[model samples]
Target: MEFPDGLVADTFARTWEMLLPSGTPGTAGLPARKLALAGPGLPDPGPAADIVLVPTHPQTGKAWQPPSGTAAVVPLSAEVWLHLAFPRDRLLVPATGGLPDGVLRDDPPPLHPAAPFRPDARIFFGTLARLPAVREPWLRTLHDHARHRFPHSFR
Candidate 1:
């Protein structure tokens, strides 16, 4: 799928942050660590990214598996994409101000390894639009981004 330029621009404009689960070196337990997305000359005045995540390993307390001369791209599934996209601290409340019927309030789901992570603007906003809880400014933002980034894809 192709993304519109606007969406790509917005995505590149802001630094995306995610806390991901990692296997601790000595223990079986999984711990969360802060990961910052980076790429050379990213967040360009225009839209685009060659994204790579810089993660701090909890066990080593250091940068985990730094990318070589060129950053590695990882492919992720829609479910795993959603998990990383939304903010971890807040519950996703619809504009209606209540949980949609039948939607349950429970612990946030875990991220399954679908594939390696990659920064593709098209996939990112496409997945964002697919999320059920999205609304308002966010929805508009996604649409605008998609429209601007990949005009033909929508038509």
Candidate 2:
């Protein structure tokens, strides 16, 4: 998971911060003020994440996998990745869709986590850098996506 050079890594980090939906995706029950990214400025990028999300080959037609278990980060990452890979430009759902099936308890085990939080993505990106094949491209794509997600940070 080798990453692009330092420049690209920096770009990706900055973009991720910007583009990611502010606060936890579905943590609505909690107070809005408690959301990490709800403040005027970016929340302290949270703590260094240590979760390990397994990986799976993208389905032939689908780019993402279904959710698994009570917790899986892969599904969440896939949704965000699809948005980054295929943005609609307008305030609409991105052209790229997400995994069709959800991770089933009775079905075969998922290759990765179902839906990870932000810190998970950060750690995942760091690990992704170690792999040589998709390292730089992943970084570049993720960076672009991040920029699209958060233009304010780049400014």
Candidate 3:
């Protein structure tokens, strides 16, 4: 079968509209050496690098992705996530209170094609495991002391 001689669907990169004036951490930049033709078309996938290739407006100096050609690169992440039975979304515990800096750790490049993961920590305090323990001291406790020693949740 033959199809129409035209583009069925088209997408352009405009991520530049969302980038900060000054680049933030975890952001990759489009290499400065590339010869870009400033016009409406997909962005050129500059040189390959482990970091992200954040495309920006040549004049505005902000993140932008042309909507048709460049196919701006949006790297997922260079960090490894923890491995546990808990859902990934449910365990959104970044080191800082905000995102892109939570419970994640900088992961070295993987030699194999697999998702980055770790077994550094896991939720072990469960209902059965928290049955007052086999033995305990009769002494009193302090604020959050019980909560820490015997967490009510695996969180």
Candidate 4:
């Protein structure tokens, strides 16, 4: 079944809320432009960039690390790492210093016989492979939804 954009965003937001710490602060809004890969070996979306949201810790006011293997191993700040994950509803500040739930998982049999990656990431990469032009529209929809849902965060 084809999932509507609203349903997909809502599902993602709900999943993010469940994974975030109880009092974690929301992100500092979506990035101004698409995110650039911070490392050399990561898959490059080129012009079809993805929206990345930078989340901050509520208490310490620090940024959380990106879950390992979710994306490329970048040397950017922790906030940048958080942004790449795109937990739009709230900051996915890990409660136990481990990977957040439902973010990354074992690769499906089609992609890799034995490996791990985020399913969403795989879909994203797959789309980029098939139609490079699809990236902007996909990210635009997400950014628009986020701007509508959380107007305060954008400013």
TM-scores of the models, in the order given: 0.24, 0.19, 0.13, 0.20
lDDT of each: 0.40, 0.35, 0.29, 0.38
Write candidate 2's Cα lDDT for 1-155 as tens digits.
Answer: 21233332332444334433442322322212111111112222233221212222345433222232222233324334433333343332225753446733344532443543234445555555565643355344554455455455433
Which segments of candidate 2 are over 4 A away from where they belong? 1-116, 119-121, 135-139, 147-155
The best candidate in terms of lDDT:
1
What CA RMSD would you report for each candidate? 20.0, 19.8, 25.0, 18.0
Model 1 stretches astray by more than 4 angstroms: 1-121
Which is the leading candidate under TM-score? 1
Candidate 3: segments with Cα more than 4 A from true spot: 1-43, 46-52, 55-61, 66-72, 75-154
Per-residue lDDT of 38-151 in model 1, one digit per residue for the tens?
323233212232334433434554443323424333333333333344335335565559887898968665544475343455665677678674455534544454456555
Candidate 4 Cα outliers beyond 4 Å, as residue runs: 1-135
Question: Per-residue lDDT of 1-155 in model 4, one digit per residue for the tens?
Answer: 11124423433445333322331323333233333332322444434444322344555655433433343222435443343433253434445675666777354322212532223534433444575443565434443444454455434
Per candidate, the number of residue pairs that clash is: 14, 24, 22, 1
